[model samples]
Target: MTRTVLLNNLDHQDLRVITRRSAALGDAVMLAHTFPAEFRDLQAHYPIVFQKSADGTTFHPVALLGLQDGQNLFLDESGWTGHTLPLAIEREPFYIGQDGDEWLVHIDLDSPRLSRTEGEPLFLPHGGSSEHLERMTSVLLALHEGLQATPAFVSALLRHELLESFVLDVEHADGSQGRLAGFYTLNEERLAQLDGPALAALHQAGHLQAIYMVLASLSNFRTLIERQNQRQAARA
Candidate 1:
C-alpha cells in the first residue's frame, strides 16, 4: 500500500509516507534483509535507485533520507521491535517513479537483519572521556557531520543518568534486530528504578546532543563512562 506523510523542515515541501522496501549490498554489514525497506518521502530532484538485494527483490527502500514522514503508520507490533526507523544510511539511494505530471519517490519495507550480528549482543565497557571536554566536542562534531552527510541518520545525544554519558542510537537496516550503533539508553537492570521526569528534563535540554557526541567518539565511550563513574564514586 502506498502511504503519504507530510514533509517538514527540509529543502523540499510535500506530503509523504513511510513505505517498506528491500535491501542491497552495503546494507549487509549492518542489517538483516528480513524487512529490507524503510519509510521515505523525497523530492523529484532526489536520485532514487532500485537496488538488488541478496534475495531476488528488485526494489527496496534502503535510501538515506533527510526528512521525516508525516504519517507514522509502520510502528512496532506485538513482541517484535517497534517503529523500525533508519538511523543512518551509508549511502543515499531512492526509487524514483513518474506518475502523471508529478514524480514520486518509493521504497518497500520488508528488509531483514544483517547476518554478521544474528545472535544476542554481549555488553562491554564504555571508554568515552570527560577530562577532555574538547575531545568530546570533537566527537560530537564528527557525529553531526556524519549524520548531516547521511540524509536518513536521525540522531540525538543525552546527558542524564540512566540516559546519561551515553545516548544517540542510529538505525541500521536490521529490521527488528537493528542495533543502535555507538548509543544506548538504560539497560534492563535500571528499568524499575528509572526516573521519568529526570529523563524528560534532560531531553528538554541538550541530552541528545551529548549522546551524539558520545557516538561520534564511540572509540572513547568507555573512557567517558568510566570517568563518569569515578566522579559519582567520589561524590558518594
Candidate 2:
C-alpha cells in the first residue's frame, strides 16, 4: 500500500528518507527504464536495451541490471557497485504529480526508506528545503523531462527501422545456462545503410549519439556475466 501526498514544508517537517541501496529497500530490479538524456552515463556501466510497454503498443529504453527476473547484479551486501545509478533508481519515494496546471512533488509515506530518525532530513531546522531535498527535486525534474521525450525518440527509431529483436545466451562456469530475450537493440546494419540525409536528420535530432551509446553499452553484458559468474563461484 502507498500513502502518497503532496510535499510541503508544513505537516511533514520531520520527514526523512534512507538513501542506502539494497534489495530489501526495493533496489533489486532486473532492468530500469532509461532515456536518451542519460544514455552517455548509463552506457558506461549498463547494457541499454528496449522493451515493449505493458500494453505492447510501444517501446522504451531500459538499462539491464541483471540477466533474470528480480536480480540486480550491481547490488551486493555493501551497496550498489555501479558508479552511476539510473535516474529512476536515484529518485526514490519522491515522484512528480500534477495539480491542475501546476507540477508538484509527492512523497510515498509507506516506503521502507521513510524514517523519523536515522536518515537524510527533507528540510532544515527552520523549515527550509535541505540540500538533499533540492538534489532530489532536480532528479525528479530531469526524470520528468526525459520521460516526456522518450516517445519521440522511440518514434524516430521505429521510423528508421533501427530496432531489431535480440536474444542473449549466457553460460556460467558451473555449466548453468540462461537466455535473455524479448528485448530490442539498434540494428546497426540498418543504421549504416541509411542515406546521408537520414543520417544527418538523426544527428540533428541528437539521436545518432544515443544510438551509438546503446551499441557501446552492449559491451557491459560481459561485465554482467562476469558478476554472475563471481556470485556463483562465491556460493560454490
What TM-score does each of the candidates earn? 0.21, 0.97
Highest TM-score, which number?
2
Each candidate: RMSD to true structure?
22.4, 1.0
Give the per-residue lDDT of model 1 (tens digit) for 1-236: 33323212231122122122323322222221111112222111121222233564222222212112221111112221212333333111223344696544333222232122332111112322222222323433443443333322122111222332233333322322212222133332443454787556545754433323322333333332333344346556
User: In candidate 2, what residue range of length 10 has the lowest lDDT sum?
Assistant: 96-105
Judged by whole-model lDDT over C-alpha atoms, candidate 1 comes out at: 0.28
| TM-score, prediction 1 | 0.21
Regions more than 4 Å wrong, model 2: none
Report the number of the highest-lDDT candidate. Answer: 2
Indicate the residue-level lDDT of 176 in model 1: 22
